[model samples]
Target: MKFVNVRNAVALALAAAFMFGATGCAGETERIESVQIPGVWTGAGGGRVEFGDDGRFELSGIPSDAVVFSFIDPPPKGEKVSGQGTWSVKRKGSIVGLIYDSTGSFAEGGEAGTLGVADGGDSPKLYFSTSSDREYGYEIHKSG
Candidate 1:
């Protein structure tokens, strides 16, 4: 009778653990799905980035005061740059990185940046930082 009781207790514990584990996994999946980038995001200084489900992206409304340091003799300051390119997302641990490829006149290169999500009521804000060292980057809000 003692052996049977112990076996039943162990089985019940295992079943409870499995149920909780499955629930936790489902919640994680919902979080990841919520973070999917497939909408128009507007940022400060009139900056905007639209990410399509088809992997195409459009960036525009960059402030002229923004600066971009290059290998040229004199680093050119950022202008009201706009471009169309392809984008891809990579997940490194818990961080989501966005890889952008520009094919516009402003520049013809790629940049990798980290994405951030804000917890502001119903509309969650999305932010993009070009450089990790910079104090201020782009703060974007989803338009739709």
Candidate 2:
């Protein structure tokens, strides 16, 4: 009986650790010069900003000035909330992994995803996934 109880406790602890570690924004990698859009950039059809390290971002279309998970602790409703945290680059097949803060919260936290940097003729265009698997994304160009 004692062994059973100890085993259960260990299992529970492992589960909790797994969940906690699972919640993160992105990973860390070598820095690469990406697009920097100073102005506001919305998502596709206005769902939410996918991924970018520039300006305030939100999922509800509400504008903000805070960068890297807006200063608002709880975050506002409708506005999914997003901000630019530190990120690095890693090569995975044809896609590049943009690893930001793993512990970040809000739109930029509790998740690990990717954003494709497509060539926009003059500059590289940015597209990020909205869902965990990265089904849809938004197009953003470098702000001159």
Candidate 3:
């Protein structure tokens, strides 16, 4: 019968292209308005955060276990500790807490000084915490 109807029409077109590629990789998340977060942000190891609408903020290469530096235990790696600070944005519906300026807490998150924002369907994400009861974190994006 015509080769089993052409192999069932190629397995129903490969099962409708794998269900539309898994619904475009499960993408659906939107709501990040703190003025949509300032700008410049990139970190995977290189680090970079420059958010300033007026609240002021700046950090480079952050990775000293997410900054807990004090009297020094060899703690100095946010590219020699960020030198500009002052920021605030605490929301709970879509979660956007980034309250810096205290030498630490740029993603400690939820209910402790704060630092966490997400919606990276293609941009926007900043949450860095190597662990300090905040569980663990590291997700920085949004640059260009």
Task: Name the 10 consecutive residues with the lowest summed lDDT in model 3.
Answer: 105-114
Q: After superposition, how far is residue 5 of candidate 2 from its true place, in Å?
A: 28
Candidate 3 per-residue lDDT over residues 1-144, each given as its tens digit: 676345434533443343233222445423466676678877776778787888777776666666432222534444443434655553332334333343443321211223444453356675653343443366667788
- Taking the candidates one at a time, how many backbone clashes does each contain? 0, 5, 1
Clashing pairs in 2: 27-99, 68-83, 68-84, 69-83, 104-109
Off by over 4 Å in 1: 1-35, 64-75, 92-96, 109-114, 118-122, 130-136
| Model 3: residue 134 alpha-carbon error in angstroms | 1.6
72-122 in candidate 1: lDDT tens per residue?
Answer: 121235556566656544332222334334454334344333444332346
Local distance difference test, each candidate: 0.48, 0.37, 0.50
Name the 10 consecutive residues with the lowest summed lDDT in model 1.
66-75
TM-score of every candidate = 0.52, 0.37, 0.24
Off by over 4 Å in 2: 1-78, 92-110, 131-136
lDDT of 2: 0.37
Q: How much is the lDDT of residue 103 in candidate 2?
A: 37
RMSD of 3: 18.1
Point to the candidate with the largest TM-score: 1
Candidate RMSDs in Å, in order, are 17.3, 11.9, 18.1
